[model samples]
Target: MANQKLKRWLKVAGQLIIAVLAIRFVVKEIDLNELKTTLLSANFWWLILALAAFLASKFLSAFRLNFFFRALGLKLNDWFNLKLYLLGMLYNQFLPGGIGGDGYKVYLLNKWYGTPLKQLIGATLLDRVSGVVALGFLACGLAIFGHTATALGAFSFILWLGLIFAFPAYYLLVHLLFKRFKSVSHTTNLQALGVQGLQVISAFLILKSLGVENANIDYLTLFLITSVAATLPISLPGGIGVRELVMVKGAGYLLIDQTSATALATLFFIISLFSALGGLPFLRLSQPKD
Candidate 1:
């Protein structure tokens, strides 16, 4: 017990260190006064719209996960599933361990529904994998387009090749994950696209809120790239510092202001936190019965 506690503490410490380093880097690299000025001038209505779009994406994500649950013969009702999902999101953002959210999910579902551990774990893993795959597809599309418009070299050719093979590769992956529910693959893929599309729209709204007008494609593309980076588990507490770093650096490639990009990422993170807080009321309650 003591050893386990020590490990947990160590994990928390490590996450804190990483978060601090990431934040410090962003602070050092960007002008804080500029970031503050930009944020202070943002359109609150636009930010609200961005938050709404982000929440809609989470709802779609909840439905997508429940689809897998139905396949596992544990058809949790939509409301209950969403509540559970929000709780999981809370853990994902705030917990110390990399897989805290997913592990909590497996534990809850198994205890509440007598779900088999292997099947529950598989469903959760697949749900995560599906999102990552969608992100990969989006990033590759953006990269290919951006490179083609700006350059005509080997790097662009490689990106083109990646785009060409992305579909077939993704198709094979879908088949592997959905052999039993083959008929549902199309619907699931559509849901994934919707989720990602809304998120991209949310980013666009953030850019607009920050007064970015003409160079939206560049900013949006950079946002997508940072979105991909944020998916990695290296960042702590809602990917706080890591995301800001990615956005600030990515903005340089597009010649967008670093402070503005950081502000955008920071606002997105705040919106995410608010959404995650929706689960707080249910955090200590037992899982709802269907």
Candidate 2:
């Protein structure tokens, strides 16, 4: 446990350093004046409206999670579920490892719901699998039209389609494998898995609406791939530079300016920070309430 905690902090430290460096590049590369002009020119109302959509997505996720827990006969309150979900995002956004937030969620599930720590972790892991698969599909689609030679060369096209198409196969295989493990929840809510896919898809839409343009098809493949990769195990200290770097790298890969990527990444982080604030109240309540 101590080792795990140390590792988490170390990852956080590394990301913070990287993020700070990335932020510097963003500031220097993008003309703050013009960036402001562009930002101001856009309709601010979409961002406002998107907030509602964000909340709705969260609600849907909570509802799906509720379905799973209730089916398993676990009793929980909506407030608790919402707060926990928010808190878990806090961990994901700020913690060092990709699973950091989910690990915290497992702890809370055990604490509040008295679930076996392992199984709670398992359930969360399963949800992540669904999300990763969803993102992979999008990335694959993005790759096909981008014209950039995939690292795989001539067979890259075939490989990309295989990967994009394999997400389903992977899920099916895992579902079957889990079924054999009697300890895993046989009553798994597959619907919840679908919800995970929708959530990522929605986020992509949100990014597009914000003016993140990827070439080829309408969306940015490099952006999706980089963002998903950065969100992996190295997100520490608000995902610090990791998210920004991914954005910069993604945008750069797609011929967007580094400054623009940096600004967008910073804006996205700010939004995430605000959303993460929902967890602050629960952090205060992290201590068991008698």
Model 1 — which ten-residue stretch has the worst lDDT?
147-156
TM-score of each: 0.89, 0.73
> In TM-score terms, which candidate is top?
1
Question: Model 1: residues >4 Å from true position, as ranges?
Answer: 1-8, 147-153, 174-183, 287-290
Candidate 1 per-residue lDDT, tens place, 1-290, comes to 99999988887787778879988999999888888888899999999999999999999999998887887788888988888888888888677655777799899889888988888887777676667667667766776656323643555566556657755676687687646545556677678878988998998898889888866766666776677677675667667788888887777766777887788888888888888888788788577644
Model 2, span 1-290: residue lDDT tens: 99987986787677667768876766665677876765555445655554555556556666555544554456667777777787777776565554666777777668876877666655666655655565666566656666444444686677467565655575576667544322333323344434444444544544554576654232345445555665565455455666666666566555656554555555555655667667776775453343
Best by lDDT: 1
lDDT of 1 at 215: 66
Total colliding residue pairs, candidate 2: 2
Report, for every candidate in turn, its global Cα lDDT versus the true structure. Answer: 0.78, 0.58
